[model samples]
Target: MSRYAILLGAFAVAVMVAGGPSFSQEPGQKGPLVVIVNISNPINQLSAEELEKIYLGKRGFWEWGKPIKMVDLVEEDMNENKSARAIFSAMYMDKSLPALKSYWIRAIFSGKGQPPLVFGRREDVVNYVSQNMEAIGYVRMGELGADNVKSIKILMDNKP
Candidate 1:
């Protein structure tokens, strides 16, 4: 009985110490969305400006001379976590999704740029990024696993 009590106390202490970083979380409890990129991409980090340029086609090529590829989920097919899309639009694009769509349409018609390669689902985007070296995109925190893709710490306004 005494040995069991001691083991239980130690287990409780361990749990209390480790609760800060959960190994996994359900959808609602998960952390913020993260910008994901291929494992071989040279970029280890990103800022809002760099992300904007790459996705907007203002930045055509990576530093290593590889063309930058932006993968995307279509607007209507966004995740159930609506706030994640909202945060992305608010951060990367000043305009709402509809306005951004219009902007892309104009860009395409003018031959100024092309919209990102679109996928129908988040997992498809993740799988594509995992397979392509120059690809970049955003995914919800809950979906980030030990895939071939990785997250670039997005520092906005010098804040992580």
Candidate 2:
């Protein structure tokens, strides 16, 4: 699938068909997030575009040929998925949700650009990331040190 097709699908699916990112704020917080990887993974950071590529299944393998395992929050009425959607929208895909979905529907049926494995809760994402060296996911900033996962700095706008 085309790179544009993949991106259009990512942010678009979560946005348009699902009513878009959740606008509600976490109580007394702005829903800050941090990307996490299993402590065993050697890489320490990722460009925003690299993340978008992995999550969109555009980059299928790491430099060492290890598959990049991706994780994500399942869509819901709660803030976790919402906050993720907001951050992903603002920092990554940058496409409207509806457009993202429409692209994916066709892409999937065509056997291209699969999305990440989705967990219903953040704890599940953390658990998955902790156990899999190739895993990558994000959580509320405070959830980082509480688990076996390590935070990976996301280079905002791919800046140095």
Candidate 3:
């Protein structure tokens, strides 16, 4: 191969390594956020509304009676628009970070519910989900490494 070709190949690999794996998104899927669940969980997909309910503490159990354990990423930087938490909040919960925090605060104060467990790193989130049979969480599409967890499709209404 020519030197130019070798250089280009190296660049491509660098980019992929820096950005994580490439994923082909499905229709109605928005952004790079991927919802993941423990491999033992029977759920294979979730509608956007259902995801919202689960994250917002409205849904507590899977249909088969297993208690739903939700996990979330820590807000690393409020100004980072592309952070996993921001994309997830916008896509699933339809709430900004501050708004979501406020919602959780009120929920906790009123004795209604609590937010999902939060972790600082995506690897930790993946590990937690893999270890807990009922756990569910979201991570950047390319960051889910080889783990005992599965990414479920999120069905969204496409109506304009």
TM-scores of all predicted structures: 0.72, 0.74, 0.75
Q: What is the lDDT of residue 73 in candidate 2?
A: 61
lDDT of each: 0.73, 0.74, 0.81
- lDDT by residue (1-160, candidate 1, tens digit) is 6999999999878976964222233445356678998988778898787787777789988888888888765435334335444456656755566666788899999999988887766788789998999888887777766469888987678423
Q: Enumerate residue pairs that collide in model 3.
A: none
Shift in Å, residue 124, candidate 1: 0.6
Any runs in candidate 1 off by more than 4 Å, and if so which? Answer: 1-31, 75-84, 158-160
- Give the count of colliding residue pairs in each prediction: 0, 10, 0
Clashes of 1: 0
lDDT of 3 at 141: 70
TM-score of 2: 0.74
Alpha carbon deviation, residue 144, candidate 1 (Å): 1.8
Error of 2 at 32 (Å): 1.3
- Scored by lDDT, model 3 comes in at 0.81
Lowest-lDDT window of 10 residues in candidate 1? 20-29
**Model 1's lDDT to the true fold?**
0.73
Q: How would you order the candidates by lDDT, starting with the best?
A: 3, 2, 1
